[model samples]
Structure formats: structure tokens, C-alpha cells
Target: MVWVRLPVYFYKRNDTFYFSRSIPSDLQHRFNKRKIEVSLRTKSEAKAAKSAAALSDRLERYWDSLRMEMIYSRELGLKVLQDTKPCTTSEYSLSDALALYHRLKGGSKTKLFYDVSNRSIRYLEECLGHDNLTSIEKSDAGRFRDYLFARGMSSSSVKRVFSSVRAIINLAIREQGLVITNVFSGTFIPDDGAKQQRTPIPQDALKRVQMVCQTLDDEPRWLIALISDTGMRLSEACGLLTSDIHVDTVKPYIELIEHPWRRLKTASSSRQLPLVGASLWAAEKIIKEGNSFAFPKYCSEAKCNSNSASAALNKWLKPRVPAGCVIHSFRHSLRDRLRAIECPADIIDAIGGWTTEGVGHKYGDGHTLSVKYRWMEKIAPKVRELRSEETVT
Candidate 1:
């Protein structure tokens, strides 16, 4: 197929300025015309450019809203005539479809997952002006992608939102048998394979945290201390129950499992991590406290507040740690520590609950909890003495 570069929505006829873009073929039936031509009727280049930009934006918004309503109406079994094509009549709105999707997609997923899905729909509604499934055009999807970037969402974040968009449309197609194409499928998604942005907490800065935790004698700080050693995700650490802590064993570790309050990230996240050093110490102290949770403030049987816990902890931790390092950097630091000691990739994966490479990793019974425990204990404690913390800064 031959492609041609199109300029930003500016055009002119006989010195009269206008904004125009070719409407997509699939969507042209809605307008009964191929091109979006809005006359500004100006002569000056600068004024014409400004007028065209505004008119172009208005026209795109109108088109998107029109398409959304058409899709939504079709999904509800309503026959909406888009040009000559007949669409079945249905009463499903974009919001209604998304709500059904969230309901159908339930089980073991966190509130945050639903939150993201809902947010994506809301963003589409905002930009496209509340239309139904038939209103969704390939052009609308492109605009939504650009809209997300305009809102300062990171590339990875944009991809995640668009993923929800795709899922919503696919679910609508299968369950409702809507004839709409998934415009979200073929959009440009930024590559995000580089290393994460969060920096690891340096060894020196870690001592400061250890000292602060020791002095605070608080459940929150104790949770921080525990995660620093175990390299558990903040949610995993914050959501621990007394039942999850098995200190009686020869190789003590916290049992990471899927709980309603705190869902495991994956099956690998369900493994038992050997708690050595400060984690062992904190686990011992936590059991002595006789509370249901290790950190009562961040965790309850009903829900885990890992995000809130991170926010609170990071607020205090930001100044203590180096720049670019947050409370979660403890997990990053442990991964680096494991790599530095030449720990095997599979073992590291097992320890961190990272998915292993290849189907071959699925065949074996996998490393025993004891084998994981052995590799975990190889790393030493982060704090040799509390005095080290006071010495720095």
C-alpha cells in the first residue's frame, strides 16, 4: 500500500482558510462524506493556522462523540443507520459495557485493576464525548492515544490504558456480538523493555533506614525492615498475617500467598521466601506483638493498603535514601544483591517470584522451598550496627 504524509489539519480554497482531514473509510459512512472540511475563511497564515487548529479539534471531537453513540446504540440492539449500513438495536452505553466487563472479569484481581479499566473508559468518554460502541473509530483510538500522552502519562502508562480499551471492545464484541472493529488493536505503543526507573537504595543509605526502624519501634518501620531483607513487594510485606509468618521452621520465611486483602502478582509470587537478617528479626518481634497482621496500619483481612503504605513510607524514606530511590527500591536492591553474588537465574526468579523463561521451567516440580531458602540465606544482613546510620549525614 502506498502512504502519503498529511499535514496538520490545514487547508485553503481561493485564499479562504480551512481545516480538513480524510475521515477513515469505515467511519465515512457516519458523515456521508470522506473529508472533514471546516472553513475558517481567513487569509492571514498565522490567524488561519490558529483558526484551523481550533476548528480541526472541534470537528474531531464531534466525529468521535458521534461514533461512540452509534456503537453504543448498536450494542443495545438498536438499528442505527450509518449511511446505508444497518446496525442492530441495543441499549448498551460505553459506560454500561465497561461496567459489565468489570463484573465479568472478576476474581482474584485487585481493586487497582478495575480502577485502571474504569479510568481508561472515563478518559475515552472525556475525549470522545460519551458515545456507544459503534462510535469508536480507528481515528478515535488514535486520538485517545495522543490524548493520553497529552495528559503527561508515561509511555508504559499509555500502553496499559489502551490495553484496557482493547479488552473492553473485545468483550463487547464477543458477549454482545457487536460488529464494531477494535480500533485499539493496531495503534503505536511505545517500547518499554529498558530497566526500571526506580534506583536501588545504596548500602550506606540502608543503614540509615535500619537505624530509623530500630528507633521508631513501629509496625510500619518494622514492615520496611522486613521487606529490605526479604526483597518482597511492598504489598506482599504489608499484607502479611501472623498465620503467613512461619518462624518455627529451621529455615524461617514468610508465606506469600493470594489473599483477598492482598492478591499475589503471579503464581511464582506465591512461594515461601526465607526470612533472614532484619526480616527474621522483625518477624520474630511481630509474632511477639500478637497482632493479626505484621503491619496493622497498612493491612486488614478485607483489603491491603500497599499503595498508601508506600506513599507514607516513601515520604519518610525519600530524604533518608539517595535521589531516585523510593521505599520500593529495597526490592530492586535485593535483585541486584542476588545478581552480584552470582545466584542462578532460576533461583533468583524463584526467590523474587519472577516468571521463569521457557516452557521447560514449567515441566519440573521446580526448586523446593528449602532450595530457595538456601540461596536466600546467602545474602548477609543490611545493617552491621546502628551506629553506621548515625555516622552518615
Candidate 2:
């Protein structure tokens, strides 16, 4: 005869001692407190009595644990049991977690995740294509790292894929209650890591980009000036609406508040950027015209390619801008200008939507434009001076 310890309750059925285990107090609390009938199926009265005694002891232990402040351990045990129990529905799968993640994210964020996850998933599929979640082991992750190296992927690239895969597994464990440990945790992938590179264009190069944007027919050309001056990400610039631009005063600025359906990549990225020099003028022209978005009409929306902006810049303005200058080079150029003028790192970080100090250093909470513009005013003159020198050269 097997006995399980559970809370005890009684029912008056046919005037007999019909003893059964009650639901756990926490679970019962979820329902209204009311009399409920329960039945204990036992062959003999002695077995029923033993069962009732065991249930009573269990309830007493539960109350004692609560009084002794061991609720955390009890809750953890309950969670483990809940996780290990057979699913009322089909067991959750890795694919199910991915689907849930997609469903939870908005369209723009979903697209971003898709872009990053696509390559990661491909690498995972190549390594563990046939393996289910239950079959994955630490050796499998190690083997995947080996495969990445064999395929000639850089250490940084492999690390990125590994991180993404770990994230996928974590989401599964957290959201789906999958009975699996994260295999990638504490595992060190070799890193033939390259130095973190910043590709900021020099002052001469920036002048050329600006000159190109000025001559080009496309409206997004102004976006080039904005990015060059403000150091906003291409996506942030692309997502910009006219409402975000404030230009009534001498000190004009763009508010990089929350995007409609997109969260900033980092908290620091959600800041305002002040407009100055040619960039300010260009933005003003666009805003004054009453267009809702700064880059409303992407040249080719069919494929939703951001490279089209770069392509347009390259085709029309290559001659004017310096060699090896991309659209993002403008941000680099701005950062360089700030460094030259000896602006405070915090001020520069705040303006550039980079959290490079204190809390931002630890967890990357981005700064505001008000903080950035204080430094922008100092650096803007140097940038203009360099542009003038370039023309003379």
C-alpha cells in the first residue's frame, strides 16, 4: 500500500468518514473558500486512517515551514514539481518557445530578432539538426563550437551565435518550463577576438558626405546629415518622425523618445540629440515642409533594405565624400570631433546616446540629448573649421 502526504479534508457522504486529501493551501486560496466534497478510495478503514494521518502531518509541516520562514524552499520545491509534471497539453518544444517570442514581440522588434536569430539558428541546425531539446547535452554545444571553427567563422562570430543560442534555450526554460539546463552557461568559447573597431570618418570625409547629400535628389540625404551630426543609429534615424523634431528656437533638437512599436537597443539609445551647423539646417528644412517622417520615402521599400540609403549615397556622392566612408561613418566622425575638443566622456556619451559611465557602463543605460548638446556646442565649431580647411586643401 502506497501513501502520499497531502492536506486532509472530510466530506459527509452516506454518513460515513469519507476522508480525502485537501488541495494545498496556496492552490486552494486561488479559489473561494467554500465546503467541497472529496473522496478517498481505500480498501480498508485502517488504510484510510493512515492516509488521513499522513495528510494531517503534511499540512502541519507546511504550516511549520511557513512560520519558520522556509517558504522560499517550499516554493522552489513546488516549482520543481510543477516543471517535472506531465503537461496537460503536449510538452513544450524549442520551436514553441521561438514562436512564443515572435508572437510577444512587435513587428519591428520581431524583424530585428529575425535578422539576428536567422544566422544563429542556421548554425545551430547545422550542428544539432536532428536533436530535440531533451537530447541536447554540453558535449553537443562544444561540438557546435568546433563546427563553427571548422567552417572558418571568426571567434567573435562564433561567440555571437553561441550567445544567441543560449538566449533561445533560456527563453525556453523560463517561459516553457522545459526540463533542461542551459548547456552554454559557464562554457567558454575560444575567442580570436578582434579589437572593437569604430569606423568614424575624418572631418574631410564628413564634408564630402554632406556635400554629396546636398547634391543628391533623395530626401534621405538629409538623414545622412542628421546621423553625421547627431550620431544616431541608422535604424533610429530611419524610424524618426517629424513630430520628434523640435526646431522653433535657436537651440533646436530631436527627441529620440520611444519609437511606436520598437524599444531602443539600449536605454542610453533613447535620448534627444541637439541639431547644429549644416545638420540642423538640413533637418529644419525637412521639418518645415510638414513631412511626418524625416526619411518617409525609402528609395526601395520592396525589400526593406537599409543599404539602399548607403547605395544612393555611394552612387551620387562618392566623389564628394572620402574613400571608405559609409553612412555610419558620420557618427564616427562626430565622435572623433568630440574627442579632439576634449569633451567630457559622460557628456559625449549622453549626446551620442551611449551610456559609457557609471550605471550605463555597467548595464548600458543611454543618456539624453541635453547632456550631449553641451558637448556638441563645443565640438561643432571644430567640425565646421575642419570642413572649411578641407575646402581650402
Candidate 3:
């Protein structure tokens, strides 16, 4: 691209630039350093340059007015800058940011983030479709907060939406170096202050669900068993392959290896879970199929839908499980069983793939099969004992 600077005069007042009648304000800073001849094609070209210069002059005066307001109030200065800073080439609209975020995640995380963020984006578009990143003020954020409240969205739900927005803005700032601040700071998000709920399935409920799974024709019976037995997340279980299992070893265990393209939701989510009893049996059956996958073809597919698995479970197994219990309740059920067996917190954290307490350490490194298996054995009997107790009651 051939670059040329037009002859222009600029005066700097209070750290702002005002330009003469032949240069764009965008070009004013450059024009001040040197003068260059413009190859004007026609009178029309000259007129266009003159008009741009006039517009720059007007904008500079408007900026001066805002700066004068800033002299009395630092808040006003910040507000003006927040409203006027240009969106960088890479900085995108809320919708665009969400699309990029999903594209980057690419796997099960893409689906999870999309499902959660879509509702929030829809609300944001309705509230501020015309407003760019630079135009989004605290009042606008507060207005949306009120709108969510009116819609009966709980405080936690509103906070989730706010967090989604904050994440998008932070991503833009980090990746694109956008000159926008996180406007979500200091906003009054509602807090219902209810106690946190962590209701795992009771032992009787799990056995009833397992019994229902036995009668179903679905091939994922072992998948459910793996979750209940090993306390692996659905994604982790789904991502497992035949190579990840060591069934023939003296002490059988599953290796929670990380892949280049895929990631566990958290580092702690990557840890070994012992293969024994039903879980080991399931792993062996899957490995014997000659396919590399430990689960069925559909479960391992990149675009695999959990709907069928979920539907089958809900239809047959959910009724057996306690009301409001979900597939994830299996992890909770396993955790509760660990607590009942007096498993140490570190051991429990390792078996269930939970992050360590406090800040520095987030996840447990792989534990030995014997160590993990002991916990599983403890868990299996506890589950059976709970079922027996419930039957007696």
C-alpha cells in the first residue's frame, strides 16, 4: 500500500490533538511529524480530504468538551474513555466472542459453554444490539441485571450470566488487546443466599437405578456402571479409549491421560480410577471389541448426542433413582460413599478426580491401582450395604 501524509497543522492542548483543514484526525498524529505532497486525482479528491479534516476538527472539539468535564470528575474522564475507545480489529461483538470461544473449545466444552451462554447472549442482544463494546456502560449492565431479575432469574443465574460477559470481555482484552474495561465490576448481582445444594443419590436410589439399567436394551449399561463405580465425569468417561485401560496388568487400572487436542475440564479431572468388578468387566468387554474405544461407537463420536443415553436413563433408570437425581448424581453418590467409608480427603480427592483444597495445588497426580482400587472396593461394599440397609428398613 502506497502511504502519503497530507500537509496539516496540529495544535496539542491538554493531551488532545486538533487538526487543520486537510488531514484526518486518525492521520493528525502522523501528519504533525512531517508534510508530504498528495497526488490529488481530481477536485473531488481534494474536497473529500477537506471534508474529512472538518469532521476531525469537530470531533476534536467534542473531545475537548468531554475533557473539560473530566477536569472536575475522574469518573467522567473514565466514562468518556470507556465510551469513545475504538474497538480493535480483533475485538468482536458479544455474539462473535461467544462463537470464537466455542470454536476454541471444540469438544464437549464447546457444547456446555454454548448451552449456558446462548441464553445470556440472546438477552444481551435484546438489550444492546446497537451498542458496541465501547458503548456498553455500567448503567447498561445494571439495566440487563434488572431485566434478568424481572424474568425471575435467580441471583446465581444472574451471576452466571455476568460471569459469562466478564469472560468474553477479558478474552477480548487478552487476545485482541482491546481498550475496554470489565464493566461488570461492582455491579449489584442478586444473592438469594440459600445454602449450596450437593445432593448425591442415596444408596437405595443408585441400586434401583442400576436394576433398571439391567432391564434396558441400551449398550451403555457399562457406561453408567463406570460412572457410578469410578466417579469419572461423563466427558472423561466418554473420552476414554481402549489404550487408556490396563486390564491385563497385575493390578488393573484406567489411565487418565491427556490428549493434545482435548482437555479435562480441570487438571484434577485427569487422574486414574481403578478398574474392578463391574467397572473392570465393562472395560474388558469394550476392549475386546477390537475397536480402540472403551465405549460404543456413538458414545465416542465427536458430535455424539447424550440425548439418547439420557433419555434411556431417564425413562428406565430415573424412576428407580430418587426424584431430581441426574446422571451426575453418580459422582456425588460415589463421593458420599467414600465419606461413609472414612476414606482420607486426599484419597477421596484422587479417586473422584477432585481438585485439592486451597490455591496452589489444583489436581492430584495419578494414584496407584491398589490405592484407587481400595477406595473402589470400599465404595462398592458401601453401596451394597446401603441397599441392604434400605431393604431392611
Candidate order by lDDT, highest to lowest?
A: 1, 2, 3
Clash counts for all predictions: 20, 6, 0
lDDT at position 126, candidate 2: 44
Q: What ordering of candidates by TM-score runs from best to worst? A: 1, 3, 2
- Candidate 3 regions exceeding 4 Å error are 1-111, 114-119, 171-181, 193-198, 212-218, 259-262, 358-366, 381-393
Q: What would the per-residue lDDT of candidate 1 be over residues 114-165, giving only the tens digit for each residue?
A: 8888888878765664334564567887888888888988888888898888
Residue-level lDDT of model 3, residues 189-248, one tens digit each, is 757874356568897666655544334524577678667677787767776777898888
Cα lDDT of candidate 1 equals 0.77
Evaluate residue 37 in candidate 2 and report its C-alpha lDDT on the 0 to 100 scale.
27
In candidate 1, position 9 carries an lDDT of 74
lDDT for every model? 0.77, 0.63, 0.62
Q: What is the overall TM-score of model 1 with all chains considered together?
A: 0.74
Candidate 2 is scored at a TM of 0.65
